[model samples]
Target: MTLNRPDVFGSISLMFWSIVIVVCIKYLGFITRADNDGEGGILALAHLTRSSLREGSRRYALVMILGVIGASLFYGDSLLTPSISVLSAVEGIEVAIPSLSHVVLELGVLIIVGLFVVQRHGTEKVGKSFGPIMIVWFVTLAAMGLTHIAEDPSILAALSPHYGMLFIAEHPFIAFVASGAIVLVITGTEALYADMGHLGRPAIATAWFGLVFPALTLNYLGQGAMILNHPETVSNPFFKMAPDWGQIPLVLLSTMATVIASQAVISGVYSVSRQAERLGYLPRLTVRQTSAHTGGQIYVPAVNWLVFAGVLALMLTFGESSRLATAYGVAVTATFILTTVLFCVYASSALGWKPWQVLLAGGLFGVIELAFFAANVTKVFHGGWLPILVALLLSTVMLTWQRGVVLVTARRTKLEGPLTEYLSSDAVVNVKRIPGSAVFLHPSKQTVPLALRENVHFNQVLHNNVVIVTTRSLNVPHVDDSERVTIDHLASEYDRITHVQLDYGFSDHQDVPAGLKVAAERHGVELDIENATYFISRITLRISDRPGMARWRKGIVRGLAQNAARPSDYFHLPIDRTVLMGAEVNF
Candidate 1:
């Protein structure tokens, strides 16, 4: 009876079309073209868009804000994806053994905790098998789907455009409402786009269209066939398609696939966090490179534990996969909308697209994304509030931190720039020029290091030759070694004072000593890595009572600063030799 209704058909139509509209067109067709030198994410997109405009322009600032919000919201979704994906599969146990349904949540939490615990060790070893494992999972899914499709081969008609069009035309209001539920199929589409940088566009596109898309098509159509044959199975047609004896193995296989998917999502969280750090949206964390051969593979312990805590809370609070699903589409929909907006800007500016071209692509995708976004908004009170709340909170922190950094830089900018006089013999007069080189890690090359100024003001001692170094994260993912370090002068590099600017890709690690050593070797500058004294500044944040963010957020900025990884640790400066000069900053 339900299958005869246009509304039922419309829902399926909307679901299938969304995958084509959002995932296939918006991501694969357009957004993937916006990758920044093999690095992909909201931040990369923002930086790429920023590169097309004049530095310090308002439009640049606007794009940066969108990226920050998207990245923050992504943080919220990353936790949910793993929890929901794993829990939903584990829940298949209920279909296998209805009596064991009670243990699903407990087992899901246990698996999630285990996943988080092993994050510290890095996935370089286990990661190699991911592609093969996923291939097997997908093949298994296709085979299972094939078993049921034979029962009602006519169900394949759902893939035809005429059915979708007729259903939407016959049931307009129901089609509109069904858009929300239908969007669930395309939830991870943005993540696929985000990871395309490392994996490359061709590989990602191949995987999506080649194996994944076909497998998904077969599985959904097969489920549709099963539901049509036995309408009672509509409640859980996915598991219902499998016979009683095969249900247990299906559950086992589903759990394995979900766990693998969840692990990849967790790795994405860490990867995005590092990108945020390099792009200056967040404070630095302790970054550990997992593999010696690959510089990109990294682990952040804090992020791992925080994500674990969030997943744990969601597990206890929602307690059901269905409830978690209610919260899923909101963050993802918002991100898609932002990605489309940003891609429009990038296409118009850098991709050399005409206004009409931008409008055509953006308008089409924007309407679909906005419709889904609005539909998801209706679910806010019903578990959808969690991610929205997390996004707002995280965005506030990012914006506040950025604002605080701005105020600090503004204050220092007026007073500090390259002190040619400080580098001169006159300023160095009576200053005890100590032995060995002193590397001053500064935020800006133009700004005189407060540590350099303070070292002279207090002890009145400076290293024989001073190196004022500032590291810049480029829009791209990897900066070539040839162009990695840029020095101020020519040969011997001004024996008394030299300004060094090191360029790194967002995915590159921040290693002050390594960058310095490489620069020294290339330039023939004298340097002893062991004895070099690294100078860094520690800011004491003070609320200005100034017209800025709310008082609560200023406090959060302070907390972030307090909890941020120490400069010595983050920059890999030798602990015993690193000198921290404390400075007070007001925001």
Candidate 2:
């Protein structure tokens, strides 16, 4: 009798079509094409769309804000994913032993803690088994679904689009509420897009259409069929699908599947955080390369522990997978809406699509995503407010960081002066010529490094081989080795002063020592990179009554900078060979 409710069929229809149209067609088919030089993510997509536009234009700024919002919401979703996925899987134990339900939260918390603890060590070994485990899980899902469908062949009627349409027409309010729950079906779709760089579009598309889609559809339909036959199992239809003896094994397998999925999401968060840092949205974080061969395998301790803490808070507060599910869709659906918006912008600007074509596709996807977003908004008081709150907080921090950096750069530029002028000035030309090379890391080649300036003023000496290394993050994902470094002997007036500009993409690892080594090998730049003295400006900020950012926001920026990873650690520079020149920046 419970299965007779319109919401049951309505939710199933919404979910099925969502996967078909939203995930399969919209994201996989169209949005994946908007990847930034084979990289796909909100930030990368935003960069691609706004690449042709002038950097300081209003449109560029607007698109970047959308990327920041989408990225922030993604971070929110990342926080909740581990808690919900693990809790939902572990909660399956309650079907076999209802009394054990009381320990679900505790067990889930312990499992999540273990997951974060293991992040310090790389996932290379654990990653090898992920494919096989996922294969087994999907095969199990398909097998279970096929068995149930055979028992109730009539449940297949729900596949007809009219069942969903009729249900929505008959019970509009129920369909609206159900839409929020329906969205849980496509939870990992964004992460799939985010990881497109690593797996590539072809591989992801093959796996999704070939294996994942069919299995998920069968599982959902089978769950609906089971609910129809045994109405009392509505409380936990998925776990209830298994027979008494199979429940424990199913629970164990489901837990492993969820853990693997959560691991993917955790890795995506680290990638996003790294990209954010490189793009100047966040401060430099400590990034460790887990695998020497694979540059993409990295671990961020700050993100790992922070997300773990958030997951624990959510689990302790919600105490049930159902409640956590209510909070989940808000961030994810909002991100979907933002992604759709970015795609439309990309289609119009970069692809040179006709106005009508862009509008037609954008309008169709916009309606679907907006409906889901609105539906999820109703659950704000229920539990959805958590992610919204998190997104807002993170967005504020990101925007503030960007703004503060701009203000500080403007001030610091005046102090350091032009690099060309500084190099040719009497202060540098008359200095004592040191024996070895001194590599100074600066953000721009046009500006002098504060460290170099201070060293010249205090020590009154310049290295015979002065390499001004400036690392710039390009809009693309990976810069080619040939185009990676440019060696410029400034104005030919100073042969000893060489300006080396290093270009990197968002996904590329920033290793100053390695980049310099490549410069020596590839560009034939004469230098002792191994024993080079690296000079980094360690700026201690002091707040002033400046015309730039608000004092409070400036303070926030200062705090973030203070806690950021040291330059030596971030650039993988040799610590013993690096010297920190302290400079005071007032803004």
Candidate 3:
């Protein structure tokens, strides 16, 4: 009854079966309404839905909400998983050598710190070796569990639906609480999808079903056997399954596996943050390119440091994995439910399903997920607040960044206008004597920006030819240089204004000046980057005593904004060409 890969008669047959199993598992992981097992999990899904919405599609709102919830849960899960996985492994040290119990927590903290420190070096160099190491880890777990299963075949009974269900039904309250702990077993499954694009669906599926899943199942069953035989050891059953001689090695191996799991979650946060920036939910940050070829391979220093600090704080506060479990399950469960809702919307819009059909399927899944969410919610008083607080803090930053962009865009739209107005004005009478044409590059769709009024009044002399360039995004993946720019004459003297819009794909970087140059030449205008002055309105946030968001969340948003890198750097505009107009506003 051990959940091992079925034996094939020959190599050809084995290959055939492997493909079949991997393909099936891949689809299961993809369509199960769960987050992508690879780097594209709930957060990636949220970005997709948000981008779709921004493109004038309102149908995906519900789906986006669900995705947000699911991603938020994952954040919570991130906080908890490291604690549990690392702590559980450390506890093994205590079981192996009882005298080491006093130092177990300290050792676990040190290990967690070391793991965080190495993250600056991209995972790619070390990750290539992860698969092979994990294979060994899985095999060891399976082999160890198999030894116990041989002694009592009945250990397989734990796999039955009845056991889990009955355990819940009889001790409803404790089971509800314990479910938070039990869910940790499958906590990393979603990582399979989040990291899907990196490992590829086929490889992850092969790794999971072929090795990880069976090993995990066997280990759980073996642990169950130990609990049944020596009920006294139920407090920590996993370690009890190991023999006296093998305990130390098992502890070492388990710690390694947990470290790998933590690494995956940390990396996932980095990937999601980058995606968020592209989709406009996050502010422009310093993104260090990790790999020349892989666009997705990036390092955000702030995020890395933040997560490291949080993980350290978690290790210090919780001190044990069990307490951290309460916080972990709630966030992950919430994320799962959110993803289901988003998937339903995607199925209807993208897949062209009928509304009722989407609702029916979504509703069914939602009920099951909500139940799990509710079960986790009951643990709020225990220690669930930690992950929620983290997610709330993150969500505030995301929302604030989004709001700031919108406000800036709105203010720009109000200030700029067609070049013809300046040409007709008597104030530009002196411009005829000026040497060269003045080009103002404003980041907006409107010909005039609100903040430009003061600049216009101060610089009364208008250029013989004025160009107001603005960039626009298209739904298509890319716009050729020839099609990137467009020009329209405004109704003012010899003054003329041009709007330049650049259509960049989500996968592409935004290069404003380069795009502007290409666009101007394509539209029959002479390219002059040197003559162009980039007018960027820098919004200085004022925190009013008037109530807005919760005090803590508002503080988080301000901190995030304060740390946000300037947009000029993000768009690769030269500092010499930039003009900073500062204005304070309340959110």
lDDT against the true structure, per candidate, is 0.79, 0.84, 0.62
| Candidate 3 local lDDT, 1-587, one digit each (tens) | 12121110121122222222222332344453333323467666665555445455565454554555465556666666776788888888878888989998899889888887777676675576566777778888888788877876776655544555554455577555555544554456555556554445566666667776677767766655555556677676666677888888888988998889887887667767666776677776677655534444556787778777777788888888777765666777677666666666556555667988887767765664566678778888888887788777666566666665665455444444444464456654443334443445455543454334445566644444455666664434356666666666554313454545566643446788787677566665544666766766666665555454555555655666777887788777778867776656564
Q: Rank the candidates by lDDT, best first.
A: 2, 1, 3
Off by over 4 Å in 2: 5-10, 54-57, 121-125, 290-297, 434-436, 472-485, 491-495, 501-531
TM-score for each of the candidates: 0.90, 0.92, 0.76
Once superposed on the true structure, which residue ranges of model 3 sit more than 4 Å away at CA?
1-39, 43-70, 157-177, 190-193, 196-203, 225-235, 349-364, 393-397, 400-408, 417-442, 449-456, 460-535, 541-560, 573-587
Candidate 1: tens digits of C-alpha lDDT, residues 89-190:
999988888899999999999988878877777767656656677888788778877887898787666776677878767767666677787887888876
> Which 10-residue window in model 2 sums to the lowest lDDT?
1-10
Off by over 4 Å in 1: 5-10, 53-60, 291-297, 415-417, 435-437, 472-495, 500-524, 545-551
| Cα RMSD, each candidate | 3.1, 2.9, 6.9
Superposed by TM-score, candidate 1 places the C-alpha of residue 52 at a distance from the truth, in angstroms, of 3.1
Decoy 2 TM-score against native:
0.92
